[model samples]
Target: MTGGRLSHLAPDAVLTAARRVMARCDELARVTADEGAITRVYLSPEHARVNRLAAEWMREVGLTTRQDAAGNQLGLLPAADRDAPVLMLGSHLDTVIDAGRFDGIVGVLMAIEVVRLLRVADGDGWRSPFPFGIEVAAFSDEEGTRFGKALLGSSAVAGDWDDAWWELEDSDGTSLREAYREFGLDPGRIGEAARRPDQLVGYLEAHIEQGPELDRRGESLAVVSSIASARRFQLVVEGEARHAGGTPYDMRRDALLGASEAALAVERICSGEHHIIGTVGQLEAFPGAVNVVPGEARFSLDLRGEFDGERDRVWNAISRELDAIMGRRHLRWRAREVHSAAAVFCAPLLQDVVRAGIRATVAGAEPATLFSPAGHDGMSIGALTDVGMLFLRNPDGISHHPAESVAGGDVALGIRALAEAVAHRGAERG
Candidate 1:
């Protein structure tokens, strides 16, 4: 990592920058809806606060900052020429309910730190010999906590905005269009946020591993190979309601019991399959009374895999299991797919760059290559440009909760690795 691999910035200075990034993540974690927890959602007041803070940090790094029509805060360090190609680095800023501090916010802060390091390498000047400009974006809504549709900000940047999204509503009955108007953004002008593929090079993101892989491997960082494709389903089990005392064990058709068996079956089936994960994250029983035999059971099934076909294969297997259980239990069942996303493979060239960056930053450390099971803004941006990702180890593999964390030294290494990746891409392009 020495001998100019990181320019004039010494190890101590990098660590200092990393500390600042962590500090800022903590700061943003407080700007949430709930006083006792972090709950910032898309287009909320907290979202606006965080964007302004991020924009200020970008300006401190000598980048010109602005918030796009989609409310994504952007910092652009223009190239030597106004029309030169650009490289993008960022992650989303929004969070799920009671979210952790490091899930998406760490990546945005790390991107800003990369710009600061690059500015140092250029003799405290904003210009660098790297041909392409660097743009850091703090995407506003990747979590989809508000409208139930993910990647709103990045989808707009990728020119994939759907008009149908305007009708989407939140729990409080606020339509997406109404939210946009309330937030001072015109729904019709969302298209302005789109970026032409021809205008850029690629997108790179550094995020927490959000899984146990890196922690198990004893590594601080890893290069992402691909993002898992996912499918969501609403499964309903139907049976006649009867008094718990009146229903005899042999004659009863219990929907809740069938659903419980189905859930266990899903877990058992997915357990033996490599890289396939299935979960019944939400389950509900009708009547909700302790004395009543449930008449209906509803549950949500989320299935994910590194590849789309494989994920679907697992789904088919689960469906058969459900059918068999329902048939044996004399219960009727319904399955409705609510959402699905195809797998996104990281570009091979970009992955190589990321690996090279890790080597340059970590000295003798070997970068583990892993696939991400969680969705990210990259899924949308991948449609318009090549996308590469770096995963920082999460010691506990806990995210979307308050216990999410990252090591300070790990953040330092992540910043160096990301900056080196940018440099690597610049040289490759030349």
Candidate 2:
């Protein structure tokens, strides 16, 4: 549905535009490492192809496009003045293994659509009427599937670059430094991608809900309250190995069993907290054989919550449970935090703007507000500017998997909300 102010662009027109955006996302999904599945890692050939396609679309909408030093695809719609403050809109382009088409791709495509709408009205005074420059960025990596650290692209832009990251290697043994060179990007020039906080007016990202909240509420779109704080750990459980048939139940010190209990403790502890989530996304037992008792177990822990203190509290409870389980089983455990990021709150002013956009698109309904449990490029961008997010409904709330989906009507409404947000913000600034 189109807002009254934009009724000149009818529902059919918005639906047609949504179809174009979805079609572009599907086309780019074909650029993947696996022949039968989607897997576009950072700095891979697939990454380059998708970036090129996005850049072309950006140019078609009157943006001056380029690949930043860190390999982020950027398209700029220059303001009347060269030094005007900037407003950025975007999401990452990379995907996890067997990922769905809409997860990150939808944000980037919808950003392009927003710019397209603005460009189409440039002749009608939208060009000279804005006080800030608009940029559409398609970040190269957010999943961090290849290097095990997320937000490489946005982190660089936030000026959080680390020299040690060059040493990170992919599953195929290609170093991050080597990949940069192969992609024709100089590692030393990464700093060129950084932006000063004063240069940005704000940042807005439109993305799929990636959860069931919006669908359950029967709403097409919602404004994000905050991005969840998260911590990840690599846990190793040590125990004794024995022949499965020869070891008595009382004498066995099965690492796998201890790990199983620890994983359960994580769930039990987290389930008691509000808006907290814990996941054992990966687990492996050593000497994976049927006849051998597990001597060692390694697993990954991903803990998240709406607030930092609450998340840490749950983590502590889980750790205490693990210690007790290890002691009872005559086992030892070790944990190392692989990654941690603080929660980011949406700026109140930006949230208000997004709410107005949603209200306008839906004809004055009070928009639902929710916190994002999944990480996004906004987590990094938040370090540089006030950040806000708009989440479109994903019918099943399933993400990462191939079944993740978005309805066409939802996409149309999302585009309208985003475009209206830009207009609303511009009018306020004017």
Candidate 3:
């Protein structure tokens, strides 16, 4: 573990910022739809509550704040020249059902603290002195928990919002457009959230590593190399349904059995490949009954890799394997791609600054670099501007659950590293 104070920051101030971040995370955790767990989804009352709270915090720190038409909460710190292009910092505020408190919330809070740290004290008030303006965004949706479509909020910001998304519905049968109106936002005005490239510099986000890489190595932070490319599919296996008691073992075309074999093949093949991950997170059989052999089975496939070509290649392999399994079982199968996103590599300049930031905070060792396997808002934001990320160590790499954790000390280090990175970027622009 590295042990050293930031050369230019006061230890007490850093610690105080870290504490404030953690305390705010705790505060946000309580604003959830689920009574016993944290589950703040998009366009819900919980979302509105958090946005209001975030706006209040932004004002307390001297930022001009607004909720974008897409429902993303935004706050801006002006540069000496108010018209300067802005450097943006942000992460999603929405969470998966039963999510950990730190995943997205930590990043948004850390960005706020970074702004607080960068302000220079004037006679009666503080002022921003950076070469460019700074903006912090709390994206409304990233997990797709309610709409079943991830990155809706960021997609709007990146000018990629699809009109078809308005037809998407949640578990309660409420359409996205109706929900937007219910949440007091105009769906027609979502375009207002789009940010032009000329109005921005780049995006930087600090998040707790959703995996255990940092914690396993006894390190507190790492520079993110890239967000993984991903492809997702819904697969269906079809066969003739028959009475379970009457169907002979040798004559039966069992869809469930074939689907199970395909699932195992997915795990086996993906495990043999490097940086390629495949998950069958959802599966179901039609006419699920004890007395009937399942006539159809459907499952989801989420495939990801560090590179697009390799990920697609692995998917081809998995498809071939599925064909073999279905053929052997005398069943028919088909697949529909539900989602795909190319990998977003961090800009070299941003990576360099992140490394410098880590170097300044950690003592006597070079900073570690890791590619993120999980998807992030950066994946969408990359379409609009260059994106970079810093990861704080999460114990046991557990995320999307109640057990996700980050140490206060690591957060202190993260805030310092982020502030230093922003300062480094400012110097470069100057």
Candidate 4:
């Protein structure tokens, strides 16, 4: 990317701006990642401190600063036309439990870079060519790891806000309302969080490729096609408790067997062709004794697929496994759903723009698509307005962990792609 395609600014200038922002954000993310619980991260001071810094930077960029009732950080880069729909570029700032730095970080920072490029091309002035304004939003709590609600801020902005989230609590039992009041945001104003139905021209987000596909294919960019639906359940299995030394192996029904069988069923349910998978990421057993048979067992099941029909088919298969395992083990069990997300299709128009941008950086960028097993703010917004996303090649396809990484060159290429997309969109709508 020599900036030949943009013709408005040098690649070095565009990349320098993005890298500078990333460096600063990396520090804040390190601090946020210090917390352990998913939902607990947003309730911690780490989130507050980061919010303050984001506001400060927003002011520095000459955008009007204001916090929504939901405490969504809004930095308004007003275009010449105030009456038409505005374009929003951003993603969530909150991370999952023990998360990595770049998941939502790239989207927020790249948005700022997009603004800088738009300003540069709008004639190196504080002006925009498009009639619609641009605002970079750092959605307050897109990762509802704490509140059991994901896409919090973006949902509100998309007019998909849910009142059910107000009752959410952390492990210690602290409610989201309590945390909100402490941060000076009144929880009662939650309704004010809604963005006008026609307020946004479209939305865009950039996130890490938390899977092996992009790296495996040797591609630096992924124009997301759809976000997979997710279905999760909590499984509890029970078996007879007996003395380990006295109880014969044949006489004792093992709870762990039920759990193990369930785990295998998840994998067997869906073949890799449909991108379906079920995982038992957490588990527990009760009673302390070297000789005693386990009395209780519990685990969590996470399932996802690229399409609804496929996901349903997989879930049915999982149910069949559970029945066989429980009956064979003579164990009483219960399974309860924890959460679910329907698959989301990214806007093709936005995907084409992102493809053009990526084409400017790397070869082999087909106008193709991949399904995201993981959820994102883009999923919620895509349902309401035209939305698209870009993915950076993750070094190990790792995320939600500190060791997660992506190459700097790939990051620079992602930035170039975003710049190209923003310019293209601006041109189309202008």
If the candidates were sorted by their TM-score against the true structure, best first, what order would they fall in?
3, 2, 1, 4
Off by over 4 Å in 4: 1-5, 33-40, 120-125, 271-273, 363-368
On a 0 to 1 TM-score scale, where does candidate 1 land against the true structure?
Answer: 0.96
Assess candidate 4 and give its TM-score to the true structure: 0.91
C-alpha RMSD of candidate 4: 3.0
Tell me how candidate 1 scores on lDDT: 0.90
Error of 4 at 354 (Å): 0.9
List candidate 1 segments past 4 Å from native.
1-4, 120-125
Q: Is candidate 1 or candidate 3 better by lDDT?
A: 3
TM-score of each: 0.96, 0.96, 0.96, 0.91
User: What's the number of clashes in each of the models?
Assistant: 0, 0, 1, 3
Each prediction's Cα lDDT score? 0.90, 0.89, 0.91, 0.75
lDDT of 2 by residue, 103-160 (tens): 8899999988887776534553334236788889899889999989899999999999
Q: Model 2: which residue pairs collide?
A: none
For model 3, the superposed segments whose C-alpha errors exceed 4 Å read 1-8, 121-126
Best by lDDT: 3
Residue pairs with backbone atoms closer than 3 Å in model 3 (clashes): 211-397
lDDT per residue as tens, model 3, 259-373: 9999999999999999999999999998899899999999999999999999999999998998899888999999999789999999988898888888887886788999999
Worst 10 residues of 3 by lDDT: 1-10
Residue 359, candidate 3: how far off, in angstroms?
0.8
Please tell me which model should have the higher TM-score, number 1 or number 3.
3
